[model samples]
Structures are given as C-alpha cells and as structure tokens.
Target: MPNSEFSGCRWAVVLLVMAAASPSWAAPIEQSDTPLPADCDGLKKLSLPLEDAPPASMASSLKGCSSEDLYFGIGVPKDPVRARQCAYVERQDPDNGWPNLFAGTGMLMTIYANGIGAPRNFDIAMKFACELGGAPAEEEGWLAHLQKLKNENWQGQDFSPCDDITSGAAMGFCEAHGAKLASAARKAKLADITAHWPSAERKAFAALEKAKNTYAAAVADNEVDMSGTARGALSIAAREAEDEQFLATLEKVISGNLPSVSPPDLAETDNKLNALYSKIQKKKDTSDWGTVTKAGIKKTERTWLIYRDAFVSFAKRNFPSVAPESLKRVLTEDRIKSLENFGN
Candidate 1:
C-alpha cells in the first residue's frame, strides 16, 4: 500500500502534517496463535458427563479453550466443533453474567452462515443466526428468494446449479451466485456512472473500481463455489492483494511522490467513514440490549476506532492485516454483534 492512500482516513490538518513527518507501514496481529484443542472426536471422549451437566458446569468445562480471536480481516476462523460447542454452552446458560459464550456462538454462526471456516450450510447458519431470537423466523417469501437464483449466473460464470431451496447447500450456493453476480453488475454500472460523479472521488472511484475488476479477473477461471469458505477466502485474498495499490500510490504522494494529493477524494472517503460511524449509532439507538447500556456501545466503538486507526500504516504495509473497507466492515460487524449480544 502507498502512503498517499492513508490520506483517505480520518485526519485533521495537524495530524496530516505529523503523519507526513514519518509515514510508514504498520500491522497489528489481533491475537497470538495457539494450538487447537480436542477435535470433535476428542470432545466426545471427554468423560465429564456432558448431557447431564448443568449449564454452569458446561460453561465452566470449556474454560481456557474459548478465545474467539483471528487475524484482522478473517473474522473468527472458528474450530467447527469448538464453535458448535460454544453455542451449545451459551444456549444452556444464556443468562451468564458475561454472555461471551453466546458471543462465541454468534461468531461461529456468522462463519457457518458465510461458510468461512467450513463448508457453508444454510440450515446451520440459520440455526446460529437465530440463536439470539434476533433473526427472522421462518416464513413465506424466503424460498421464493432462494429459488430466484435459477434465473441468474454472472452472465457466464458456471454458478453451481441448484434446484432445491430446501437444501442448505443449494440455497447457499444460489445466494452466493446471485450476490456475486449482482456485485459485478453493480461495479460495471458504477464504472459507467463515475464519469458524472463529482471530480473529487472520480479518480479514487476509478482506482477502486479497477481494483475490484482486477480482483474478479484474477479469480475468473476457477468455478466459484459459494457453498464453501474457500471462495470467500479467495475474495478476501484478491481484494487484499489489490488494495496494496492504493497504499503504493499513497506512499508516493506522502513523500511528494505523486503529482497531486487530490484532497477531494480524501474528503469523499472521510465523509463515508463518518456516515458509517453515524449509521452504527443509529442502529444502537434502536436496538434492544436487555441490560447493556448504550454507553457500552459507544465505549467499545471508540476503542475499536482507536485500535483501527493506530494500525493503518502497518496494515497498508502488510499484505493481510486489512484494507480500509475491511477495517470498517469488521468494526461495523463487531458493533452490531455487541448490540445483538450485549455481553459480547
């Protein structure tokens, strides 16, 4: 990533001057890697009487093996059984003083729903998504949406064929196809419309748009399986690879390397960041948090922002920490999770 790209982040004139004084790449690893504990088989062999164990006992049993950390943009790459067990423990003790178990459940479910660490399964995803009574109950119009995929497929990308929405694999495969197709089409449309966009974000828009297409092109050959986590990983890898261009460009600009710094584009992204921050606030305002206070939301978000900005340079320098969009995505997601599960 370039130094000039850093300008897109939140900044005041003074900070900009200071940042310019010593522009450098920085990355922060969220958690230390640890050895994986008992797999599903090992977990089953535990003679600790799981079935009859009370919720507290179960929760106590999983201690020291429940950290939900992962790399910057990977979300929680949970151990399938550990994540499942995490949910089970939480479900058994939903009223724990610290609902972190439920938090772990939500993380695992997110991975399951998206097929991040394992093959995607709609039923399992829904099972996890609905754990907190926050997701919509099964209803009509749902299957209709999943079945709509039969009519679309990225123009020519061999989207996996699916005939039954009842199958989690089919539903997930179709949804992934539709979403990717829609994303590609949307980018094409944006490219055409950018000619009319205000000049400030025009160049930046073009860069990002091109970056996205480059990413798509890189993965164009392989058959994209939306029902599995590999495809998602590919997307992340491609995007991270391309975002480096932004940093590369930024680096030149910071050292007076580029012809001009284009304050307009910086303003544009800044506006977007602020808007997203406010959006989270609005979501918090309306969400029901049982006993958790809105102050928790504010405090957590602020801490996240601090942590996020601190590593901007390092992330730009490193290939995988996170891009700007990834940073916002994780933060927004973490905020929403907090709202949904207060103790999280």
Candidate 2:
C-alpha cells in the first residue's frame, strides 16, 4: 500500500476557528518590513518549531479514536493501527508537488495499495490517488505493492459491531465524554510539554505563547469590515496562511519537547456524527415515504452540504481574517447532537 490504509481506522480534522466573545479583530503578528522566517528553517531561528502534517489526519500526526480498538493508542511502530496510519503519511514534500507540504490524498492511496488497515485493492487505490492528484512514481509503486499483498492473500477487515454506536443516547453521552476528555487531555498535554522544555528553546517558546495570545486578542476584536469581496477573501487567506504557519511552529516545538505525546483519535466526535448520518440514510431508505419522493433522501444530503457551506461561510465573514475551520467544526459537532436520532 502506498498510504491509504486507515490505522486506528479513525481520522482527525483540525478546524482553526477563532473563539471570542468580543467582536473586534486585528492582525496578530505584525509582519516586519523584512519578511521574517517564512519557512521552517527561518521560523526555527525564531525559536518556533513547525512540521508538515496531513489534513484531517487523512495521513497524519493527528490520530482518531477507533471504536474497534476503543482508542488511538500510542507507540507508533509497535501499534498495528498507528503503524498502518503512519504509513499513509509520507515525509516527501518535494515529490508531492507542494514544497514542504505533505500530500494528504497521496498517502491515502499508498495505504490502499499496501493494504495497511484495509484490503489491498490496486484499482481502488489508483482511483483515489488520481482523485487526490499525485506523482506517477507513487502510483506505480503502489500498484506493485498491492500485487504483493494479493499474492499473500491478505484479508481485509471492517469495523466490528462495538465500533458502531447506533443509539442516540449512547452517542450523545459519548460526545459529552469526548469533549470532557479532550479538554483534560489538552491541558495535560500543554503542561507536560512546557515542563519538559529545554532552556535553549525558551525564547522560541515565549514567542509562540505571544503569538497565541495575540491571535486570541485578534479573534476577540471581531468588529472588522465584513464586506465579502475577492479582495477581502484574499486578505483573509493571507492572514489565515500566517496563522497556519504559526500553528505548525507550535506543533513542531511540542513534538520536539515531548516526542511521546500522540495526536488525538477523536473517535467519540466522529462516531456520533457518522452514526447520526447513517441513521438518517437508513430511515430514508426503509421509509414508507407516502407522498415524499424516494429521491428526497439524496437530495436532502446534497442540500445539507450546500447549506452547511453557505452557513459556515456567512458565520466566517464576521471575522474575515482567520480560518473558519474551527467554527465549522463546532457547528458540525453541535449538529450531530441536534440531529433527529432515527435510531431512537
């Protein structure tokens, strides 16, 4: 497999939304007339660490909770789940066409071809890799690997019944538990990392903290021009790009400080959402639609996507200067809870 097998079989998504009660916004890090460290090396000089990570844990440092394993366990090399997932994430940014950037989809295809967590299917792997855009060399290698897995007659696996949380009450409880657990985990993680920080990186650590504080202040000051235009979008994109870089620096430093800490699996959050969505489909599929057209189910899904995008976009306009991924995530998390539990 070139990198598509889902280890822990769970994915992680990081939505960086500004959380503030105030409506004022501003540029947190004042860009110097002399462009300060734009790349990791430059940023490293600034004492800020950064790493290239895959989006949504598709092939990532971020881990997802698995109902099967019940947890996205640590110990990457030893853990079957972690090893498989880590395989999906390649370290070659130059090959991916994005300088210093990891290819999210390319890694996924690798997993499929290698049969990391799922079945070894060359056709499926190639299909996904093509969709994700790729370097041809990866595809050829993946093809060969899939053939190898096939020769061994490697079997595939699916999520066990325990992995599927169908009950509304159960899922809801799980979400609450997840939220609480995440909060504690984050606090502990931050404390643990800081405690272990070496003196050489103290300046870098302070800079990172200042960046975080300023970003928070900016998010709070949201009283900015909400005009939606190409120019505004570009401006937002620029700032968001900076924010992403700042975040990457933080990730790198933390990894440096504490090599043992693993990214979250976020199974609780995902399971609830997946179950609710599945229930909706099952209900629609088995429904006695009466006057409602059978096409309504799929239409509803499509419409929901459109609505979600628009709604998030609008909410994001208020800030117009930061990434709305976090807002989208919060909204998404809330939505699963609000969804009509068909299984109930």
Candidate 3:
C-alpha cells in the first residue's frame, strides 16, 4: 500500500479500537423505573454496593445527586460479592471514573502531538493517542488539552499537530495549533513592518505633503505671507511630486487596498526624495525668512499634535457608556495610561 494509504488505515484502526473500549459502548449506564432516594446523603448511601441489586435499584439510589456527583463515583463498590455486586455497579455506573479518565486522556494526547512526552518516537505518539480512549472527548476539552501541548512544545520551534490530523476527536488539537500559527504569523507581520523602509519614507512624504497642502491653501485663499515660511515650504513641496506618487502606492498597501510596489521602484523613489529634501534644506534660509516662516512651521507642528490628541480623546470619550462601571473605569484609566506613554 502507498504510505498515505497505510497511515489512513492506521488511523482507522486506532479509531475503531477507541470506540470499542469506550464506556458508553462497553458498559452502558442504566435508567430505572423505581423511585429515588430521599436526599443527597441517602442517595450516596443507597448508591453503595447492594447484593443482586437490579439496574433499576442502582438508578433509584442515585436520584438526588447531581449528574456531576453521580458521574464522580458517588455510589461505588469498595468490596466484591459472590453474587457479582461489583460487576453490576460497574455496568450501571461506567461514568464513575469518566472525569479523571477524560482529563488523563486529554493530557496524554497533547503530550503525544507536541512530541514533548517522547520527542523522537512515533510509537509513543501512537501509544498516547490510543490511551486517550479514541474519540468521544468533548471539543472544548480537546482544545484546552492541545493548548497545553502548544505551551509545552513551543521551544523556538513551530510545530502544528492540527495540520497533520483531522478528526472530530482532534478538533481541540486543531484549534490550539491554528491559534499558535496565527500568533506566529502576526509576529512575522510585525517584524516585516519594522524592517520596512516605505513606512518611514511615507511619514517623511506625508510631512512634506501637509506642508505643501497648507501652503497651497494659504496661497489660494490669499492669506498673508505673514509667515514668509510659505515660499520656502512651497519650494520643498514642488520637489515632492515623485515622492507623492510613491507615498500613494505605500498608502494603498498599508490600508490593505492594493499590492505593494516593487522593491526597485521603492528604492529609486526613496533616493529621489532624499536628494530633493537635501537640496531644499540647503537652500532654505530659516534665519532670513522672518517670524512668519517660524510661526507657520510652529502652527503646522501644533496642528499635527492636536489631530493626534483629538483622536485619543475621541476614543476615550466615545467608549461604551452602557458597560459596567468597573469596565468603564478600566477603559478610561487604560486610555489615560496610553496617552501618557505616547507623550513620554
């Protein structure tokens, strides 16, 4: 048989074995027609081993206990009887040890998938998976188990057990593995952002664009060259047409609206903008432009800061007012902390 086919067969056999061993199949719980015990203590005592007790009697004995308690071994046999009282108890109360078995199985499966239990052994993996009782485990329980596996196996390595297996039994495993992969992908993305030259170039270009837009608007409106700064800023703005195009392309990428520009085109744009800025700065006479130029620059800087502050203020002010007071307080405090951090 092909390797893939053999693996598939192996999984099928494993599943079959698990199904056969499950308590629901091997030792089904019984429902009784008899009346229940009076209270919790009576229920507990009544559930204890009873010689030749019918399935109905066993069920009646557990009447007042919660399902959780019933499943937790409330009326278990501590000794054997010639009439097979223990056997009856086991048959009628298969779930007596289910919670512990479920937990152990979950833990074992996680260790196997993560390779933490026996890192180099496929045999151990198979063994652990088999012991997990084959597939009736709850999805959430399995998920939690896989998360624990991920935490154990995350040692500068990215291993995903979910990708290799797909069974209802492994749903939790897949979810946890997917979550880890997503986290890794996010970190990779953030790294890409840090190394990217375009964002920095875009910021510089945006500063120039804002200066140009303000100067152009002032000129159009016939506002005083009250800040002689306008002419020099206009000169810098004129040199930024190529940068403006590059910034437009980057903005599209940052906003997830389009593909990124080619690296060569980006490099060429960066060089061109740097050269233009250098030339403009060399020609700019900050000393001779008079207070108007200084005033205009200061005003532009103030406008940007105001815009930033307003956004933070808006976020805090419009936060869900209907939320619990404690939640609102936390949100308000966190916002204030963030603003302080930004200022620092």
Candidate 4:
C-alpha cells in the first residue's frame, strides 16, 4: 500500500491560492499512483489479510469484531494499531461463517479513510470498499466514477464515500448501513435458535416481531425529539437498541431465565409512574421541563402504555409461565427512569 504522507498536506489549498498566477499543474505536486482495480486482486495487493483469500458475504461483517471494538473504543481504549492487526487476523481466518474477512477489511477502510492511526488514504480506503462489493450495477458505477477521476489526473486527494457526511441525514444513512450489517448477525442467531420450533410457535413469534417493530418505531419517533440534525441518527439508534433488546429478550425466554414479578410489584411500579406523570403534567410551565411540553408528555405516555401492553402480550405467548405483570413492571420502571432523567 502507498505509505506516502506527502499527499496528506493541504496541497489543494496551496494550489487554489496560487491558481490565478500559476497554471493548474504548475506546482510539482506528487500524483497518487493510478487507482487500483476495484476487484479482489487489487484488494489483495494491499497485503492486508491475504492475496489469495476468497471473497466473503457482507452479512454480519461488523458484529463482535475486535477491529470494530478497537476502532470505535467500545468498552476499551481505542488503539488503531491493534485495531488494524485484529482486522488482518480476522480476514485471514479460515472460517467464513463468522464475521471475519469483511469485518477486517471494512475496519481497515474506516481506519484509512479517517486516518485513525495513519495518514488518510482514500486510495486504500476505496480499494477496501470495492472488495465489499454490492449490486453489480451500483458497484460498477461507483468504481467507474473513481476511475474517471483517476484518468483525469485529478490533483486533489481522492474522496472517500464518507467524505461528505456533514449532516444528520447523511450520518443516519451511514448508521443505517451499519445497522443492516449488524442485523444480519442477529437474524442468523435467531434463525438458529428457532429452527426447531413448531408452526404455531413460529406464527406467534412473527406476531411478536411485528409488535416489537411497531413499538420500536413509536419509541424512536415519540421518545426522541425530531427538531435537531442528529434526530435521524438518534432515532435510528433508538430503533437499533430495540432490535437488540428483542433478540436478547427472546433468548432469555428460551432459556427460562426471565425475571418474575408479582401483582403487588406491578402495582407499585404503576403507582410511581402515575405520580411522576401527574407531577410533570402539573409542572409543564416550569423551565425544568426542558423541551418537552405537557401535550407531548401525554402523547408519549399514551404511546408507552400501548407498547407496554404489546410487550406483555408477546411475552405471555412465548412464555406462559412468565408473568405478564413482570413485563409490565419492568417496562414501567424503564419509563420511570426516563422521566427522572428528564432535566439531568
């Protein structure tokens, strides 16, 4: 891979400032090597995982990968060197079923694109992205665009696909792409767990999934204010969390490890929620309410109540022994926390 940092300087700025007096190519600026082929052969030339490594599916490519964790600083200090090393190790692994090759290469793309631990190299980043592949026409079109730039001998640094992500909508789209990758892993695991279920059970699970999705959408739209640029990203993040929680709750149910609660416990939680709701409604004129108004709070509470009932109904279908009251209590407690944290 190209190791030159000479291209990292503000060469474009310098040229622009002197453009009126000097010719377009007057400066002896170094040109990047011709764009690499957007193919596995070009990917291998980067010397990352291997030269002969086979292409892998993009599904579940980012789930539970060390490179992802290191690069994103999830539960550990971010270390770009280790991140790159882990990515290389993952890609070279013989097991294609696990999220390995694409995960590694994808992380490398992010690392180079963002200059996490090295000079930003869009050339290397583009090469990594091409290896991921996509619908044939779209993939070819993207490569063609890049090739055009190379052929024209564009003096400016090559652009990464992520270069123009300046707004919430753009970031949200980026997160949506990542969510699709992560969702693949969750779907795979769910399939494995439910492979032996009866038709009735499968049908019930489908209903539960539909209910969960409805509730998730409600939560994203109602719980989070949509007035800011990050609203898109924030709303997506909320829905993603709901997806994860759905899978996790199912796993717990299958394992018979779901917590149990009694009627009294449910009543107490409901009482607390009611008290908090009344207080907030009466204090709507206070500055402590922040951006949320009394009407909005009422609407959110109504939405939450519907979600709580749907959750309980779903839980009862899959795990009859599990108390519906327990689910209600837990959901109410979650609402309580959300209310308590309003001004904090």
Instruction: Candidate 4: give the clashing pairs.
Output: none
> What does the lDDT come to for candidate 3?
0.33
lDDT digits (tens) for residues 1-344 of candidate 3: 11211111111101122322222222322222243322222222222112233356555553432321122222332122211322333323434232222123333333334333223222222333443443433433334443444444433222233333444334333332233333344435544643654665545434544544553343222212224323332332322322333244333334535423454554554455445434433445554433334344334334433433332333234332322233223222332332221122
**Per-residue lDDT over 1-344 for candidate 2, one digit per residue giving the tens place of the 0 to 100 score:** 21111212111112222111111122222212342322223322221011212245463343432211212222122243443344234332223222111123333343444454444444444333334322234333434444444455556432111122222222222233333334344445666666765664554455445544454233212211223222222223323433444344344433333122111323555566777767766664533322333244344444434444553453344234434444344434644543443334
Global lDDT of each model?
Answer: 0.35, 0.36, 0.33, 0.55
Instruction: Report how far residue 252 has shifted in candidate 2, in Å.
Output: 18
Flag regions of model 2 displaced more than 4 Å: 1-120, 130-132, 154-189, 193-208, 211-344
Candidate 4 CA-lDDT value:
0.55
Please report how far candidate 2 places residue 190 from its true position, in Å.
Answer: 3.4
Off by over 4 Å in 3: 1-119, 136-169, 195-252, 255-344
All candidates: CA RMSD (Å): 21.8, 25.5, 26.1, 14.6
Per-residue lDDT of model 4, residues 1-344, tens digit only: 22211111110000011101110112222225765666645643443323212224432553345765576554467676667656655644444221122245545555655566545555655565565433345345445545555566544432443332332332443565456555756877888987898888888777767766777776676666555556656667767777887676667656767568788888888998888878877773545433446676677677667667766776687678777776677667767876774533
RMSD, candidate 3, Å: 26.1
Arrange candidates by lDDT, descending.
Answer: 4, 2, 1, 3
Tens-place lDDT per residue, model 1, 198-239, is 675565444444543443343322212223333443333333
The runs of at least 3 residues in candidate 4 whose Cα sits more than 4 Å from the true structure, single-residue gaps closed, are 1-170, 286-293
**Backbone collision count in every prediction?**
16, 30, 3, 0
Give residue 209's lDDT in candidate 4 (0 to 100): 74
Q: TM-score rank, highest first?
A: 4, 1, 3, 2
